[model samples]
Target: MATSSDSMLAISVFPSLTGAESVSDEELAKQSVINYVEAVQTGNIYESVKWVVDTRFSSTDEQLEQYKESLSSNPFSDVSIKSIVPASNDTFTASVELTRKDDGETNKVSYQVIKRTIVGRY
Candidate 1:
């Protein structure tokens, strides 16, 4: 006696019910880098922290403020991922290019992104 809504809920809860495959490690790492860079460029502290695991910041608030200050000081016109290479099983090195908003200068940077599983989620 289940309704269509009930069926939808079940499918949403169990993705395997729809035959959807899990994301690969490489794809996850690449997406992590993209999300982190996008969040930084947009000055979104919360979103930026989601993809980063750093111990340098004393606390979440401190990290947010630091990222905010950095973004305000050096705004970017564009940020793009040039390449992503696997550095280890769960780590990837991404090459990125950024264009400054004020001077239109481009700079290349490398980011080491590590995929972690926390509470049964990637």
Candidate 2:
């Protein structure tokens, strides 16, 4: 089994603005963030990656669609949100904890945030 201190999870963050006002409740905002991440971590690629709202990340609509179709069959798992740090007024970076279903090893997934949504993964 692959075991390491770093999981090398590639969490890509995008630089797109949602333009929505920040939630006043910190805990609520955190939960909202967790919910977004968890949705993507479930690996419903079509539904998950669609949350990424950055043009630079998608490049083209076709690419995003293709990515969704390709990753849908790949193995993925549910994750636990360990920590979330606000990087900007709306953006946050979070540490995602997971146990590989295939190997049973624990690992962490870190990513840049795009506020109020799941950034994306590739």
- For each candidate in turn, give its C-alpha RMSD to the true structure in angstroms: 14.0, 7.2
- Poorest 10 consecutive residues of model 1 by lDDT? 2-11
Q: Which stretches of candidate 2 lie over 4 Å from their true place?
A: 1-22, 25-32, 53-78, 116-122
Q: For candidate 2, report its TM-score.
A: 0.51
lDDT of 2 by residue, 2-43 (tens): 323321122333223332334343344455446555655665
User: Which pairs of residues collide in model 1?
Assistant: none
Name the 10 consecutive residues with the lowest summed lDDT in model 2: 6-15
What overall lDDT, based on C-alpha atoms, would model 1 receive against the true structure?
Answer: 0.64
Q: Which has the greatest lDDT? A: 1
lDDT of each prediction vs. the true structure? 0.64, 0.49
True-vs-predicted CA distance for residue 16, candidate 2, Å: 18
